[model samples]
Target: MSKLEIHQIPVLNDNYLYLIKDPDSDAVAIVDPAVAEPVQEKLDELGWRLTHILNTHHHFDHTGANLELKEKTGCIIVGSKADADRIPGIDIQLEDGDIFEFGTQKARIFEVSGHTLGHIAYWFEGSDALFCGDTLFALGCGRLFEGTPAQMWHSLSKFLTLPDRTKVYCAHEYTEANARFALSVEPQNAALQQRFEDILALRAKGQPTVPSTLGEEKNTNPFLRPDSPDLQETLGMGGADLIDIFAETRARKDSF
Candidate 1:
């Protein structure tokens, strides 16, 4: 079995910087190092050297520490080749459909480009793990900062196709607020209500909600269930097109 260890480096109040380690080879991979100091400290504490830095997008909060971390650890910084100019000092410029291995774990790159024009997500098929960045959140999706509604809809649809058991690691700890919104939309949804209570308790103890399974997300995340009657009705649009449903939800969340 492939060994996977995930570290959540809290940065900028709510952002999460993920460090994935393979014990067999002592290989390390970081997804979205928002800052250098904390990531550096965590790696030193764990005695793990970073081999690759996986970028989800070109946003400063996601890739700000890339150059500094690369310089400090001599690690390869990877991101969408199309975003090379935006994401500084990228070494491994990957495109959609690219597959590569880190130790015994292999990852497939998916161009989930709605969060940013060239955003990407990494999937470890063997581990059933997904580093989705800002594309799909615990119970929501990122605001449409760059891409169109249609683009975001398409990107989210791709994620919804993954196996329900896939573990999703997003870049932030917005689950509490997101679950609150989800409950508002699906008040009668037993799963959403239960999840809200569970996550509330988790946060109450000052814990981090990092990895959420795709099965749980499918059951409670309304953004991924635009076709569901509950979500469609909540948006006040009956039989609305997928793009419209996505747009409405995103608009509501921007103010939420």
Candidate 2:
């Protein structure tokens, strides 16, 4: 089996920054760091040298820790060129189809510009791991702050094409609340109900319900399943495209 370890660094409320490590090579990469202190402490504990700083968007909550962390480790900051002005100290501006090595594997960058104007997600194809930041979440998606409904639609559509087994590593711990909204939209969805129950059990024990696979999200995540006849009909917008359903679901959650 391939050796890939993903660490969740809880920072600033429920946000879960990630540390991607390769045991064999002892190389480490951090994704969407919101705070530097916690990440620095973890790196010291693991005795791992930071190699790359992978950012998903230009939001301060996501890239605020970039300069501080890079100052300490001298690691290169990688983010989308379109948002270069917003992301601090971005040394390497990445675009779609760009491939960069993290440790023992390489990550293919996909331009997922919905959550933010220049948002991008990293896919480590060899290990079937995805560092999606806020573009794709466990049971929800990021609020559309920059892009339009159509842009978000096309972006999520591309992600749904990835292999079902790919593990999704989102940047925050918003699963429980998102699941609640999901239940409202798809009341009879057995998969959604079962997942909500499972999450409740985990949280009841003070556990983190994250790193859900693409297959699980596909079955349960409403934002990703706009084509479901049940959900489409319930919204009173049957025959509407994925973008229409996505917009409606997002609007409902905004008020929820």
Candidate 3:
């Protein structure tokens, strides 16, 4: 299979809109476009027409451009079946484990609820790329807007089973702030400390710290490390259930 070309377009303060293209067939898909103008501009520049719009959830920041983009390009909008009523212009309703194709590329849907009950992520096995909207972030996870800590933990556990080399493409650029909060939780984590410094340097240069590998996040993201003894000890929750540890970590982050 030919390699897929992915472009990251920054919009609406910190949200990222991804434009993916299949080089073999020149088919294009845009993920979670917060606005239409910028996405349209990028599509014109790439000389690629949008054929699909993949929505991870029904949040405005993620689906605000769906209707406009669909009207403009006649692209089919794909989103979670659970949120069909909330997602605008949805053409395809996807359930967990459902597979869809964009040209030669195939993606499996994962219903990862936490940030939102119907939140879903797209995993492209061939490309080892995961488009996880707000459910998970680079160093942080999304706030519990409509789901419980246990639900979020269960959702996150699904991601942990993915290949370590999978590339994580979260929606927002909140890594720097998340790193600061992570340090307070596990100051002795050598890997987390190193990653914090690396993120600092990247942000200093006005660079993005996204597209981080799952392996790297496993080492550094506190939200994904409820099983870490150090973190559990820091939270004074040693021998606690993983769900309890996760809840405490998320609660601390809320105040941090």
Candidate 4:
């Protein structure tokens, strides 16, 4: 199978839009577009036709360009079956675990609904790539906008099943701020401390620190490291339930 070529397009204040391609078939798709002109410009620059719009959720920032892009390129909009009513110009409704195929390229769908009840992530197994919208971030998870902490925790657990090398293509550039909050949660985590410095350097150069490896996040992201004894101790919730550690960390992050 040909590798999936992904182009990261930073938009708005912190949102990221991805333009992906299946080289074998020259099929191209965009993930969670916030605006249309940038996508159109990128498509024109690459000379690749936009064939599909893969929306991870129904949030306005993620789906704002769906209708316009679909109308402009005649691209089919693919979204979660659970949010079919909310996604504008949706052409294909996918349930959790369904495979979205574009020629030889295929992605396994994961319903990771913490940010939104119907949010779905696309995992391209062949490419070892995960395009998780807001459910997961580089160093933080999305706020509990439409679901409970238990629900978000369950959604995050699904991601743990993927290989450690999986590249996390989350939907925003919130890593720096997340790193700061993570340090506040686990100030003594050596890996997190180093990661925090690394994040600072990256942002200093005006660089993007996205597409973080799942291993890196698991090691440093406070949300994913709720099981860490250090984090539990830091929160003074030693010997606590993992979910409690998670909830407390998330709650603190809300205030941090």
Candidate 5:
């Protein structure tokens, strides 16, 4: 069993920050820290020293605490080389395919852009975890803020290369609303219907619905299933260009 401990810290209206600890070496890292206080409090509670800060993009919410946390903990910050100029206090700039060693566990970086032009995900191979910041969500994707539908599609498609059981640790709690859009586009998908029900129940109980499995997302997420017949038909883009189908679905969701 993997001993990589990940603690979820919810902050400021729907954001999820991951505090990850590697058991073998006491290496601790927090992914996309928006606020400094909660992270610092958590560190004190666990009596663990923060070592690194992992950022997937240059968004303000993701990098807000970079300076404070670095000064407070003397933690090194890691981010994409392409967007290093925007990432506050970034110490190690990495590009796609680079390996980031975290104590005993390591993450293979995948530059999954489109949420932001330089957004990247850290796929911890042996840990069965993917810290995908804002590119892919539970059932939806990030809006095309600085990239195109084609870029987002290409970015999301990389997840298909990952193992079925890989846990997708996206940076938000958007599953319930994303499910509504997914069902509207692919109502015929039994798996998606059931997932929607499950999402509603989870949200109703004030629980998180993130970290959905790659296999489950591939089987149900409409954004990931643009080529599926039901979703295509629902969008009236039967046999349309794959990107076109995805674009239309995303357009509709933008208004949703």
Candidate 6:
């Protein structure tokens, strides 16, 4: 296998569209192309042809460019099998545990339903990258739009099984705001405090705080720390079930 290169393209509001390429083969795939023009521009700039479009869900912001990009680049659209009907121009339907290969890169799909029931994340183990669309964020998790709190908990738990060094490539740049909410829930956490300051500086400079490692998120992300004594105490849910604690934390974030 050859080394893969991933480029982050900022799109609508805070969304990020990734351009992944296998340098050896010159094969490229676009992840969640929110729009067609910018993606096409990127492909033109790189002088690479788009071979595939990997969509994480059916959200308009994520798949809005599916048809146009496919028509323009003749790329095969790939998405969750569960969302085939909702995903525009889907040519390849993937399910949990499916292995999708392009050039020298292989990605394992994980059906992490929470933000949406059909939301799936692509983990390119060879590249140490996880393209998690909305299921997990920098410091927070996606809103419970279609799944239950328990289901979201289960979905997020799956990420814990990955290597701590895995780089998380989430779909949005919501770290700054998420940091604020995290601090509210774990005010006494020194790790969370330092992370908030770091996020503040990064956002101030118009820098991206994405591609955070799983290790960093496990230590600082409140959504992934349901067992933290400090967070449990802050929520006044000490000794409560982890799922309930997680549910309470999510609810607070929703209203935060």
Give a tens-digit lDDT track for model 4, residues 1-256: 8889999999999999999999899689999999999999999999999999999999999999999988888998999999999999998999888998976988999998878899999999899999999999999999999988888999999988899999999999999999999998899899999998899999999999999999998888889888888888889998988888888999999999
lDDT of 2: 0.88
lDDT of each: 0.86, 0.88, 0.93, 0.92, 0.92, 0.92
Candidate 2 local lDDT, 182-201, one digit each (tens): 99999989989999999999
Model 4 regions lying over 4 Å from their true place: none
In model 5, what is the error at residue 23, expressed in angstroms?
0.4
lDDT of 6: 0.92
| lDDT value, residue 221 of candidate 2 | 92
**TM-scores for candidates 1 onward, in order:** 0.95, 0.96, 0.99, 0.98, 0.98, 0.98
Q: Model 5's lDDT to the true fold?
A: 0.92
Best by lDDT: 3
Candidate 6 residue 201 C-alpha distance from true site, Å: 1.1
**Tens digit of lDDT per residue, candidate 5, span 1-256?**
3568999999999999999999889789999999999999999999999999999998988999999999998999999999999999999999999999989899999998898998999999898999999999999999999999999999999988999999999999989888888888888999988988888888889999988999999999888887799888898889999999989989999998
* lDDT, candidate 3, at 157: 94
User: Between the candidate structures 1 and 5, which one is better when assessed by TM-score?
Assistant: 5
Model 1, 1-256: lDDT tens per residue? 6657877788898998888987678679889988899988888899888898999899989999998998988998889887888987798888888996788788899888777888999998878889989998999888888888899989888888889989999998999999988887778789999889899889999998768999999899988877878888877888978888878887888887
lDDT of 2 at 155: 83
Off by over 4 Å in 6: none
Report the C-alpha displacement of residue 2, candidate 3, in angstroms: 1.8
Angstrom error of the Cα, residue 137, model 5: value is 0.3
> Which parts of model 5 have CA positions greater than 4 angstroms off?
none
- lDDT tens digits by residue: candidate 3, 1-256: 9767999999988999899998888679999989999999998897889999999999999999999999988999999999999999998999998998888999999999999999999999888999999999998999999999999999999999999999999999999999999999989999999998999999999999998999998998899998999999899998999999999999999999
